[model samples]
Target: MNYILYAVPFFFALIALELLLDRWRGVSTYRFSDTINSLSAGVLSTTVGLLTKAVGLLTYTLAWQQLALVELSAGSLWVWLLAFVLYDFCYYWNHRLGHERNVLWAAHSVHHQSEDYNLSTALRQTSTGFIFGWIFYLPMAVLGVPPVVFLTVAALNLLYQFWVHTRHIPKLGWFEWLFITPSNHRVHHAQNAVYMDRNYGGVFIVWDRLFGTFQEELDAEPVIFGVTTPLASWNPLWANAQFYVALWRDALRAESWWDKLRIWFMRTGWRPADVAAKYPQSKPDLRQFVKFDVPLSLAQKLYAGVQFSLYVLGGTLLLGMGDKLSPAQMLLGVGWMAVGLYALGVWLENRAHAKRLEVARVLLNLPLTWLAVQLSLLSAGPLLWALLLGYSLVSLAALLWTPRTAVGVPA
Candidate 1:
């Protein structure tokens, strides 16, 4: 599970590296809202990520686990390799449709909405993709790709996608023709008209090149980053809903019912005459929007950094711990972690520094949730009694702080 530790820190290290390299190479990586928005999205996405994993598990077990029609004629290595290729192929279609379809865009646009393209942008994934996502890999299951092999390959393919999200690397010359290079994937993240809806390949750029969706970053018309419909708010939850809601409003505003549905499937920027006349397509110019310094509070930045680090570390640990722990115990532990992290976040937002109290809450949850996990053998009475006492203390503290504005976001 420390995979998150390796992957998440590596992401930040590369992000810092990219900034340094950007200074040397003179590619501007500055965008004012990038850090805050990226971090906010990261928090929201992490909260929802667990829910999607459950959805994936349910889908595989219930629906298309039957689709795994092909048997492994040889050993496990062959099956794993084939699963890798098949999963990538399925991923290719999933990615391609994410760009092609509107409903999918609602889930996926969170990743592309960032104005800055960096390693942090790689972590800006959607929590809602599991809805239609299960469809992409059904072919593999039907072809008889074993569940374990399929899951492993899927994770590996995802791991491969992480590095390409950075802007530090130039096109790998001919390598661009085969693999999905940073250059090509940048097109996937770009907001430029030519770059929009292009380069959907996950591990292979050849898919785009073969499919005629490939575009290169040009010196003359430098690519401007972010969506055509920019996320104008710092609230990450709103970022997930912005486009979908906009589409909904436009659909409602349409003069005809057919025009309502047409707003989605039509070209991305297409809108009803009434809607189009009121809010035109936004053209983002990086030169006008770049901000060099993030200007975060020493306290807030440090707190956010700590929270993000913990999630990445804790997520990786839990991922590996999955096989060893009972599902009940894992769920119990995760619930405590989630609540503690969010409570820590709310406290941090309010500029409250109660680290010792926070630590106590976390430690309390670990043993309690652990007991909850082993409930078959262990009695729940002690755990319940302890939880009641902890809740009472926390509730009293909440009562004392009720006069202060903890919910209103502070500057």
Candidate 2:
């Protein structure tokens, strides 16, 4: 039923409320470039999922049809309850292995890339998880849980997780013992020595407790958010590819064939002895840690905010119409969106060629709009063309007037 799609509005509303809380408490939890980059990763993940989700659904459906021990009735209340619990149990291991294994961490690290632990951080998801994530849930299919029930519970489990990714919430005393809470989840996100790989349950903390992987949040040792290897940039595409690229480079440099082959499947951060000795990489000093930021002028900030708002709107529309669109149409839309996001990332970085890239993006909108209309992705009309022309002209003016000045600092 695309439950996450339906919850998009509420997600943004809560983010807005969190921003209000930040202002009232005089605490800043979101930075402009960081939040935009986080949301961009999320938007890209959701858009890519529209085309890739079939992999998981089809595999699960085939497994249920062929290997079910017994046919489970979708109408039975017990089936739903059991599936809900079971999905979380599977999710615990999938998430745990995602942190423990190198190849899996390459995909799951997107969620942990954002240094700021805010509501926007929850939306920072992996676009490539579809490749291997479905293997974890095959037990439910084998036990004869219906596909409908599996989908619903999976959505509910994910929906339950969104609210736990904030810093404003304090520990819920007794409530913190059994279920996943904000405090415990914050510990899960922390990169501290004490908190590195603990607390991996999706809905039930009972799984972590039973498996000996739970850690309580401590006031004496405050959580340091983000991964050990900082992402250090606002580019969404690079954020997803950063770890994989590192692993690839390591694999290429290893002297042993066995080391090269096993590097991907080895434990997270395990490098060949040769590679480690030659190209050493060290975790940043916690005491000297500073959040990654880039300077931006006021005009640049306003332009970025307005452009990001448009992408959010466009991405939401694409999601709503996903079922009705052709694959070609979806590909074209997603491709254009990706280019726009990359340009925005460059702008945030204040790169030398950012102005030219942005100007190209603004100009490309006209032909892309015409292509979309011709492809039946958009309706043919004069009003649409007029609106596109007006937006491009305004965007071009802003791009020209906004000097490529690095005077203003990130908020």
Taking the tens digit of each residue's C-alpha lDDT, what string does model 1 give over 1-411? 324435656676777887788789987764434654565566556545554566776666554445555465335687777777677778888888887777778878988888777776877777577778888877776777766666667767777888887777777888888888788888888777677888887887777777788888776766677887677444456667777887898888788888897778776557888777776666656567642233334454445455445555555555555555565655664665555555544444443444444546555654664565456423566676676567546544543443433333443
TM-score of each: 0.72, 0.98
Candidate 1: regions farther than 4 A off? 1-6, 19-33, 63-65, 258-267, 272-411
lDDT of each: 0.66, 0.93
- Please write out the lDDT profile of model 2 over residues 1-411, one tens digit for every residue: 789889999999999999999999999999999999999999999988888999999999999999999999999999999999999999999999999989999999999988889999999999888989999999999999999999999999999999999999999988898899999999999989999889999999999999999999999999999999999888889988999999999999999999999989899999999999999999999988888888888888899999999999889999999999999999988888889988889889888888899989999988888889899888855788999899999998998898878532232
- Candidate 1, poorest ten consecutive residues by summed lDDT: 402-411
- Specify the highest-lDDT model's number: 2
The parts of candidate 2 lying over 4 Å away from their true place are 407-411
